[model samples]
Target chain A: MKKLLDDPAQAVTDSLRGFGLAHADQISVHTEPNFVTRAGGTPAGQVAVISGGGSGHEPLHAGFVGAGMLDAAVPGEVFTSPTPDQVLAAVQAADAGAGVLLIVKNYTGDVLNFETAAELAEAEGIEVASVLVNDDVAVEDSLYTAGRRGVAGTLVVEKVAGAAAARGASLAEVAALAERVVAGVRSMGVALTACTVPHVGRPSFDLADDEVEIGIGIHGEPGRQRVQAAGASDITRRLVDSVLDDIDLAAGARVLLFVNGMGGTPASELYVVYGVARQMLADQGVEVVRSLVGSYVTSLEMQGVSVTVAVLDDELLELWDAPVRTPALTW
Target chain B: MKKLLDDPAQAVTDSLRGFGLAHADQISVHTEPNFVTRAGGTPAGQVAVISGGGSGHEPLHAGFVGAGMLDAAVPGEVFTSPTPDQVLAAVQAADAGAGVLLIVKNYTGDVLNFETAAELAEAEGIEVASVLVNDDVAVEDSLYTAGRRGVAGTLVVEKVAGAAAARGASLAEVAALAERVVAGVRSMGVALTACTVPHVGRPSFDLADDEVEIGIGIHGEPGRQRVQAAGASDITRRLVDSVLDDIDLAAGARVLLFVNGMGGTPASELYVVYGVARQMLADQGVEVVRSLVGSYVTSLEMQGVSVTVAVLDDELLELWDAPVRTPALTW
Candidate 1:
């Protein structure tokens, strides 16, 4: 696959430069590299929430940085986890006197690297806590891999804890909030098209035009299964059904619904999904108190969508009600 | 062009359903037809901020509904403007006591329709104000074709104004703040691939693998001109330079920079662009106080990036700092 680039390795740096040029008022690039933060300010006495991973998902780590969300975000190359050193640097930069918490999606490399970075930060006297978001209900109780591969559900945990941290919640409180969000949330996705990582220059996988893969991880990694393309309403049901079954967001529970595009599906389709999903939830006696429909979290350019449900409580709802300003999801 | 769908007309509604399902908590279908909001319990009196356009851009109009941002967002079919009635209904739902402000991107159809809606709202005794965002430097500043097409910069205006409104700033205040963001922001983009609108089922334009369309619009419209595809470093420079020259974010001035993906470029490339932009701004002694990088707004699946700069002031900064919890950007 041909792509516009000087060098594949330099792609991330170049992309960050473009990002800096466009949103320089809300964020700043750290001198220590790969670390970005809200312009000129650090969270004070609040848990400095930090998260990072492979670079492909735009706005996830970086766009999430601001007052109500992540204090700092570090991005590695496409599909490659941020190095331990990068994670350590982000933690150091975001750390106020309060401490820093790393929200790691449950990917092996990310977990290992962030854990290593936490140790390094601890060595430097920076109080660091780690919260793993393993909310993807798609990855079954596996014999091999970890439980579920975290996909779009990371955004929910990030926002919930980010809101708490923004409210001056302590590191422990923020960590607990994050863990609760992870526990309450469940996500599942399908991809209609395989993404072409610029460096690779080809589709990650090959499927006929009518086929879509279910349980797709963001990176186009081989998913749990492939299925014939179905209608959007049907797809939403399937995704939500899996998530509902996984988390048992029982009848009458207050839920936060997120119909997230895996990057490619348009808002037009997402909106349609919303109507069907609302009806489905209502039929199940689940009350959706709030909903987010869009590409807040995404897989590259995969033409599919994911369903994320967060069983909410008063506290979680309050946290959710807190304001946030990120580049992607702003209120 | 190949796509995963049964029929073209069903794409938008179908997608909306899926979107609603995902973010069911903070959003819900505006049962009165084509609008969406945070699941339930509309926070009344907040200056109802409604933004909409064609459907391709996800997490833009709809994903941005919650406490601090838009009260409702309506989506049209793929690349098709929402009808006036849809806008009117959204305005009605959002108008509590304070009134409603329309944040319209400068596309001709959107402007005309939103303008009509504003009139309808005023007739209904709901105070209404509107700020048209025309920040795309790529479009020729001719008396021709209504003003310059509002590109990704619309997001900035919506966020600042939405935040102001969420804080109980009146319609006038929100409108004025929207203008401030509009005045300070400028964006220019280049696309490597011609996006295909779903209904159209064909590429909007033909761009060879090594060709780039500079000055692209948000609707997959052809850019000002077609040129050979260049490296990310070079493309970043061109787009950023266009924005910088269009608006003099003078040396030593702190500005918010936004590098928006036209919906296709990988975040890896975005980071690289961010780095180049950082150094470029430094070279001119322009201090980037805040930065936003990602596909905050998009033009379907075009491999392109737009650079938007919002020159910040004290008031804009506070407005930017206000708390907001929307599906797309929360803080």
Candidate 2:
């Protein structure tokens, strides 16, 4: 594989440095502990939005910290959630007296560490709230497991609640908005090939050229099933149908449609999927009020796409339409 | 070549259908004519924001259609611009009684088609204005055979101007703001590997495993030169410095930085780039006001990153901070 870098081991460090230098105004080196946050000093009475997970998903937590998104995003190594101590520091750094909201995906390690930090923050009078994001419809819940893993849908919650926070909506309002976004959104994905984690240095999954895994998670977790590769129209229909089946979207209810590239699918292909997706909905008498198609949320160079839809109401629409300026998301 | 598809020809069409089905509420299908617009119908007398280009840049023209962004977008095939007719129709669809502003990249086909449509709109008595985005510093001259192609910086123009438009700013105001965004923004890129342009069944360029191409265009265009593959930090610094040198960024001036993935790169490396990038900028006394790091704009799976910095003033910053609701971008 051809790449522009010296040592693979140093690749992550190199990228972080570049991120800091590029955004020296909004972000800086929080070295003693590590993370990226607004360089212009934290504001008081603001609910600190602290979220972190793996490093491979750029513009997620870190790229989101700005006017209307996240206050601080603690990016861990690729596909690895930050440790408890790191989460704790991020929470502390983002704290501006109004308390912080910990946005943690429902992954095992991420949830556990963040929940513990929430408790610790509460003990320290920081007052923290967390609404676990489990928008992935492909996952099955086991009583022993940490529930559904958060996927691309976290972006919806972050943007919605982040907007609410930016509007000076109370913490309750922000938390409530986040929950509504979580409740309304559903996502499902498929993978044509397993992506090799950077450190692992090998293919994550060994699928044959002719096979494609349906309903796969972003982290290379097992998919719902493997199937023969189908046409874009067929695949697009299946993915959207699966997600809609997971949630009973009212026939006339407005929705915000998102066809996310799982890192590798190109925009052209995504547009093709969008074409089919638009037709399928019309065939079903559903009226899409709004739409989003792109790599807004992504997996690391995974060759596939995920379909996400959020049932929208007036309030949700307002929040969705709100202005925001962040590194990953703009406008 | 582990793509999950029966054939490549139907990729774009199928994807669009799937996209429609998923967000059936907010958007409707444009069968006879391709293109999706707002559900409530384009308001009369509202200045419509219209943008389109080639297809692979997903979530760009299409996803960014809503209250604060684009009114409608026309999508073409991958890496190929839409026909003059398609663009004209979208302009018609998006045009409320007020008129329309065409936000076009500096690509030859896009500019030509959009320019033609502007004439057609004037014939229809519909007011039209345009801002040519030529933010790529790599492609220096505004006058060239292949002039500076628009890159991720287009998103900023869209967002900033979209905000101004949403705030009831006049067509002149919106057009002027967009030009300012285009003027303030500058981007440069480097590619590590050539991308496969599906139809060609070959790579756009060939780079030795240890070599990197700097100042490359998103559409697999050649760059300034090729050098040995250096660390991500080194490459990012060079990319940043290259842009800085071309534009004399005032010391202590606040700027919005963007580090974008050229399709195939992983975020793990992006963070490393950010870290070093932050330190370097601080050392230069350049303040990174706001930053966006992600795959906002991308080539078809090219392994590299492009750096974009938009010089920000108070008004521009406010406009940047304004809320926008589009499929690809949300605040």
Candidate 3:
């Protein structure tokens, strides 16, 4: 594959090493545990927030680590879950006098390892709470997930929860906020093309030139169905309708609409999707309070787009507006 | 060819309509002249900064319209320069009591149209100045450019110049700062594969499975040379070496390193490039004071990366660090 990599096996570690130095002003890298923590450390009395998953979805867990977002991010290999020991190290390093909160995505491997780490942290007399993010409405079952896979909505969760923690909320309060955000958020993705993992050295799947996969998972897992490729508005309608059907919004409800590119998609297209989504939402009388259009959480070089809508209340909106200073996102 | 667009001919206007609606909070769109201006007009006495070019480079001219960036942005069709009338409209709309400044890239069409707009604005008794950015070190002359095609460095120019204008600098001061930024900045890009325009319905160019286009232009035009694919470090080294060779740095010089993805590359890979770039700069005793890694200026869905190095003096560095509140960039 013509990827900008050295060795497939050493990609993760080498990337992290580079990541740490590139963002050294904002974070510190711990190679032994393979985690990134805020450079200045979390406040003494503020709850520490941590998250992680496979490595390929960049700027997710690691790029979100900073003063207002994540306290620490533990990274695994491209599509592999981080070991429990790695998660434990992140928890121990991030925990101050306040308790720790683990934001785990709803994947089987990630769930097991994070849960085990939570138990280990508790055994060490450190209070820990976990929130599982399962906001992707794309599929109910996948090769690596049980119910639904966590997708871009995890970004919304981390932002809101991290804001709560930054505001000196308790561990229970932060975890509760994360779960509340997850409950109100729904995401669905459509892939125009498959992605090639460096190690795999080939595309994850193949499709006819005129075909596309609707509601595809972030890992390139099968979606609801394949169909003839359509225009931006049509594809956006499918994703937006699926989300609107899954969630109930009052006539004048507000939401933070996030139109995310699946790695290789351009911002021009994302804005097109956002434009179509905004018109659709207006037709349905759902107001878009705030919107983000770009690649926040992405698969590696997958050509597609994912739309996540989080129904927002005043409190949630306030938290989202709070200043966040991360490498991937900053305000 | 799969693309998230409606009619290929109407793609530019449609995307702009969507963009205006999505960012209505920050900017307003005018169709007659075809430009996006600040929703809240510029301050009465502040120098009004404006920039524009062909569309498809999202977050460039349009997305950069905000409080601390451009006062207006004019757009043309995909890879086609905006008409003189369009540029004149933006100049008229954004001109405060003080004056107006236009930032034009080095492409021939962009330069001619913007220069004509300046003459028109001056005829109307509005003070105006223009700066032409030609920072790409890839090729001296190309299909669309006379000398070098302005690429990602235009973002730096707009940002620094925007900050200066926001500080109430005169049009002359703002234009001078922009010229200084262009003088110190150098950039080069490499493309792994070609992009397919919606209307074209085919790849812009073809590449064998194992080959890559080195020093490729943002429009997929030819670069310095083509070679077999290389590793990230080796590719980065070639780019960095070319830039270093073109510019001379003092023993303890500082620079701003911007590693931009050409729409389709991932952050993980960019960070890997940044790592190698930082080490190489350190080896040369050039310290990096600031760094930005993401897709800022881009070709639509082109799978590539571009490296830009701007040798910064204290004044330029301060202007860069100054707060910016654009849709695509914020400090």
Arrange candidates by DockQ, descending. Answer: 3, 2, 1
Is 2 or 3 the stronger prediction by TM-score?
Answer: 3
B1-331, model 2: which lDDT tens digit per residue? 4443436665556556655554455555464456767666556767788788876666666767777777777777777877778878887777777778889998888888888888987998889999999888886533322667788889888888777877777899889999988888888888887787666667877889778898888787777889888776678888888788877777897888777778777765555666656667778888888877666687777778888889888989999888766555666
Native-to-model Cα distance after best TM-score fit, residue B60 in candidate 1, in Å: 4.7
The model with the greater TM-score, 1 or 3, is: 3
What are the per-model DockQ values? Answer: 0.35, 0.36, 0.75
Tens digits of lDDT, candidate 1, A274-317: 77777888999999888776666766666777788888899999
**Candidate with better lDDT, 1 vs 3:** 3
Reference-based lDDT, residue A303, model 1 = 75
Candidate 2 chain A has its poorest 10 consecutive residues by lDDT at: A139-148
Provide C-alpha RMSD values for all models, in order: 5.3, 5.5, 1.1
Ranking by lDDT: 3, 1, 2
Indicate the worst ten consecutive residues by lDDT in candidate 2 chain B: B139-148
Judged by DockQ relative to the true structure, which candidate is superior, 2 or 3? 3
TM-score of chain B of 1: 0.95
lDDT by residue (tens digit), candidate 3, A173-273: 99889988998999999999998898889999997899989999888989999999999999999999999999999889999999999999988888888
Q: Is 1 or 2 the stronger prediction by TM-score?
A: 1
| DockQ leader | 3
